[model samples]
Target: MCNTVKVSPRKLDPETRAALVDIAAKLLAEHGAEALSTRKIAAEAGTSTMAVYTHFGSMSGLVREMVHEGFARLERQFAKVRRTDDPVADMAVLGYAYRQNAKANSHLYAVMFGGQSLAGFSLTEEDRQYGRYTLLTVIDCATRCIEAGRFRQGDPRPIAHEMWIATHGVVNLELGGYLIDPANADRCYDGMLSSLLVGAGDEQRAVTASMAASKRRRRREVEVDPEPAEAVATRR
Candidate 1:
């Protein structure tokens, strides 16, 4: 009888899995979703096509994990924004965190937000809801603002949604190359946040103070841990 041999698929470690997800994100960003191919991704990642299957089951599985990774990064950034006694200031910091996350992960941001669907993958409603969970931090901040009388009485969900809409608009535009000048983009974003807070029943002076506090906090973060060169270059 002929000897029989069995070969098991190679298992990917956590680091390799994360690297593959990032590689996929970069490819998706550079080539658009429809252009993504498992062979290309595997080649660039220095792995076999079977590695993708072994790790993620299929190309669609890898894309789904990309969406999860994007939101996971955003959640981590949001988690770093410590809450303060000033709810409005806290909310402002959250907004900044949202923008920072997008800038840091621009390649994944579009995929995370449904801007482009991968050729073989579509986000289910469940996946969309998972992304929305990242907004809970904002909702909590809005609730505090309402409780503090800084914002008009309303459901926190709508208030959070409004903030998300405003922030996302600016971020989307900046990513699309509409807001090219970094200085101009910063000014526009600050102005938009201030206006939105004012419209939400915050006093102009209070919004100004909150924004200043947010800036100070952000500056301290930079001083402690500066952005990577690539991120700075991307901004410029």
Candidate 2:
């Protein structure tokens, strides 16, 4: 005869889980994926290694959740972009939102974009699509631009994709310290976005006007609700 005792999984504590995820993301951003270890995350989070397992099952699960968190943040930023009559302006705002999300969550951003890879973890095709799901908002804005004749009459996916590629290139460079000068980086980013809009069949003057409008809207948002102290400290 054999006797067996079964142990149930620990219930997740949302606050503790969130804290651990945040600590993991910060460590990843500051020290790279190589620094991600269950022991280290537990230590930095002031919890036990068992907490990590309790919340995420494994380190890979934590990494996967980090990727989801990155996209979730971007989605929130997109949701904050108020829709305006000018679809072109809205598209530009989406681009700005994308950049802001990446900057604000650089730790998760790096992992989300494959800047670093977790050991024994690989994103499946479904996981990749989940990430791309965030771009649907941009595509919707692009579609509106096309309907309004602001962009060429064609499928909007490619236009949205090109915008994403160009924006990603600029952001990636900025993150890599290639665009060190703030003024230069801003110029480069704005110029690149403007060029993409123009190439997408919008008039140069209209593109400039749309981008200006987007900037103003972003400024208003910041004025209305300033960045938090913690975020400011992190940015600094």
Candidate 3:
């Protein structure tokens, strides 16, 4: 599945090319990494196979575009919180956004950062530029937290990497089907975020709230009325 599949996307109009890229992203989000096929994308986009080839050059090229676009979206999400004066809060918000984006774009998330790559293709200058922008955004937030004494005094890059790993663990677990309780998402999110923040108290609040809610839900189910033997037999 990681082998290079030759195609092209160099000649399509800018609008059509953009549309095709979006269509590909949607398909990737709905399906897993295996859904990113030029033939399949062309069919879904109502265009010929040649169009994909003309615009993107190959499946490798298409994947590169997806990687670039994915990082761009990440950059935009971070940009929204760039002006927040509270570094600790900003970092937590960034963690939330990061998880939301990863869960929402699992396919692209898997392809770009999932550590698998196509043969003979490496990330290009443009790809690195987009990736650098993402890293810089993370570093910027972490650096601010460090500067404000909201985080430990150390190199912000490693701190940022650590935070990313912790946050990704949550998203990856959920994606891998290990995190089943939707009500526990807030608890899990806050628990992960608290490990990164130096002295945050909101984590306790979120955890307590989620745990209480989960308990109430379980108790409600236990207390619910049951069906009669005849109804049970009918269902069976």
By TM-score, the candidates rank as 1, 2, 3
Pairs that collide in candidate 2 are none
Those runs of model 1 whose alpha carbons end farther than 4 Å from true positions after fitting are: 1-11, 180-182, 221-236
Per-candidate Cα lDDT values, in order, are: 0.80, 0.79, 0.64
TM-score-wise, the better of 1 and 3 is: 1
TM-score of candidate 1 on Cα atoms, chains taken together: 0.87
Full-model lDDT, candidate 3: 0.64
Best by the TM-score measure: 1
Instruction: Write model 1 residue lDDT over 1-236, tens digit each, in one string.
Output: 99965335444443556667777788778787655788887776665677787788888898888888889888888888888989898988888888878887887787886766576689899888867999899999999999999999988998899999999999999888887686688789899989989988899999999999989897554222323323422332
Q: How many clashing residue pairs appear in each of the predictions shown?
A: 0, 0, 15
In angstroms, give how far residue 109 of model 3 lies from its true place: 1.4
User: Judged by lDDT, which candidate is best?
Assistant: 1
